[model samples]
Target: MNLELVTVLVLALIFVLATARSVNLGVLALVAAFGVGAAAGLSTDEVFAGFPVDLFVALTGLTFLFGFAQRNGTIDLLLRAGLRLVRGRVALAPWIFFALTGALMSVGAIFAIAVVAPLAVPFARRYRIDQLMMGMMVVHGGMAGAFSPLSVYGLFVNSFLAGDDLGGSRLGLFLASFVFNTAIALVVFLTMGGRFLLGRTEDLAGAPASEAEAPGQTSGQASAQTSAQTSAQTSGIDLYQGVTLLGLAVMAVGTAAFGLDIGVLSLSAAAVLALMRPDDARVCLANVSWSTVVLVGGVLTYIAVLEAAGTVEWASGGIAALGVPLVAALLLCYLAGIVSALASSIGTIGVALAIAAPMLESGELGAVGFVAALSISATVVDVSPFSTNGALVLANVDAEHRDDFYRRMLVYAGLVVGLAPLAAWTFSLLPV
Candidate 1:
């Protein structure tokens, strides 16, 4: 076979192997990169040059900084503070969780669901809300804020666009994702028993004070303790948390206002925080998502090798030959959505955009809109029970209803997979 066909087949093989073996796609891609690079007569330096240093630092730094916030109880504190705003209104609980998850994901999408799912699942059961609805909202919330300029997903796409000189708007992509996901969340809320929760209030006075303090406490005592803890949490912020918040604000302003490098700023902020609490820093360091870091690095490195081998141009040439830009765009969207449902959304995104690069360069489609459509198409499917976010929700559910929840999630995911790409295309790409 020719080099182009061989490269394409190898890429497909990598995905298939990774999915079937549950191996990190990045690792598989890295290996493929070396093999392909050799066959293409590329040098060692050229092969190594594909490693995405900027993306690596960004992923590592952001995850490392957030690890501090998570381990220091700041994230939980923020969640409780947001929950307090509901004031025992059961209807607002899902929205509250949704908003909180979005806020967390705006800075970084990693672990946002992991942090919120356990709390949200229990809240749903206690308030008699539909567990499926609550879970869907939380996942949607993460997607909503997932395209912020600072978020992992945002950086991944934006970096690729910028590096390739593909004209696209960072802010536009963010807004598109936020609006589309929020609309989906609204639908989930209304249909998933949200209307029933309206005007219904929970008696927080009788509720457990805290999960930790709930054990071995009488109902009356728990109520009193809950009141005390709520007041304290609301009234005061811990020293470390306050400092972390300040660092976050600084990072935001510096990146948005001064055009500072996000990766550098994140690491700088993390380092400063570490200096203050060496012990906590050590613990948080270990918690960074190294697997994700490796995944991104490996996949992008392979993409670089593909570029060197003329594989991207060859693939895009075929796509462009389809003769209709709109049809090609929709095809790419469906490809991303289908693969992302069962594999890594992050990995799928890199591949999808890489394939679409030449078609986008033709100027027939609006770059920003197409990117948004593609991104939404890829990520919105994370509600599939096969994805990490859906699995987390399933795992947290009560054992009695777990089977039912899984089936419901599966059906909902199927619906999303079938419709979301078309909807995303019609709304985002068709406008162009």
Candidate 2:
């Protein structure tokens, strides 16, 4: 009932509303953080502390590193190999891209939008598939990694849990859900139909027709096509670059061997890579998303206000009081998933865990129940209108196909809503 707590609660609601309506998540997060901090009588310095400096530094390094890799043919090598491997297997491109992206996402601890965007077009062209589908594939694949323990949000959640056994609590359940989610993504891609892409062959074959035309007859079209093709060719990676291999190895070793935090370690690896080729530093820097960094930083600092005001504690109590046990418990978790979808997963999971941790300690819910619920609820947020993944996928699609893209998103969303919760319920019954 405290005024500060009330202010935090209201701010949280407003943040979710803005995000749900497709407002810039980072901007909305910053506004909520600052607004709540001011209302709750927090100092400006304290309010700004939530800015994730470590995350920013690391991401900055990663941006530069990725840039170098692109410049030096590291990423290009990988792309070439990937494309070759995907040859004549266009329908499976999305799934393969998703898996690879998921792996990288875990290491980088941020969405690979920059990396995915430029490359998706080539893969689309090669497979004679729609650009929209290619975009969705990369977006969807990259997001799967976001929920992994190596992800920034995952680390944030684990940090909040403190002594609680997060890895032990839900590792199996999370893995299971990942499998099911992958299956669902595959199903969606298959439903799009492989035959729809055959028409691309005629367009691709038309390249010869242009050569037969006079230099002036098809000059503009040829020039544009050449540029697009060159861009795509540059994006291809060798797949055997020593730097690229070393970088991946270092990321994995740093996380598992040294127990170094991914956010820090990821950027460190990227920095090292950038330093190895200072000539391309600017490209690497350009690749980094300063906007995302600033956004994440602002929100983190702003949420610190709620922590100070004890708003999280109050909200947790309200959620627990909803009364669900046995069969109804599944419904409760599903509803929580929807709420999480409306908010960013990070916000919902953070506040919910702060509340739920104590409940688990009190024996109201088992470790398995908590883990299942959290994982399911968190994953569901990926499909929400406020979802970073959803936004990125939609943004990258060709303007002409946005409606079709959105329609597919809705279908994907329905699948997530149903399957995520079912997996949660099934996991709840397991012995984890």
Top candidate, metric lDDT: 1
Write the residue-wise lDDT of candidate 1 on 1-432 in tens digits. 789889989989988898889999999999999999999999889999999999999888899899888877777777767767778887887888899889888987478988888778866775678989999999999999999998999999999999899978889999999999999999999998999889988753334213322223354764566667675555568788898888788888888899898889888989998999999999889989888998999999999999999999999999989999889988999999999999999999999899999877878788888999999999999999888888988887877788899999999999999999988886445443
Q: What's the distance in Å from true for residue 227, model 1?
A: 9.3
Model 1 CA lDDT for position 81: 74
- The true-versus-predicted C-alpha distance at residue 295 of model 2, in Å, is 3.8
**TM-score computed on alpha carbons, candidate 2:** 0.74
Residue-by-residue lDDT tens digits, candidate 2, 1-432: 676567656656666666657555567667777767787777778877767666666556555555556566655455445545645444555555666666666655365654665556444544446655565556556655654555554455555554355334324443654665566556556666544543232322223211222223355765567566665454434433576668767766877678776556656766666666665666667766676565556555655666677765565566667765335446556766776665666655554565565456555566555555666556644754346666655665555566776887777676677667766666555544
How high is each candidate's TM-score? 0.94, 0.74
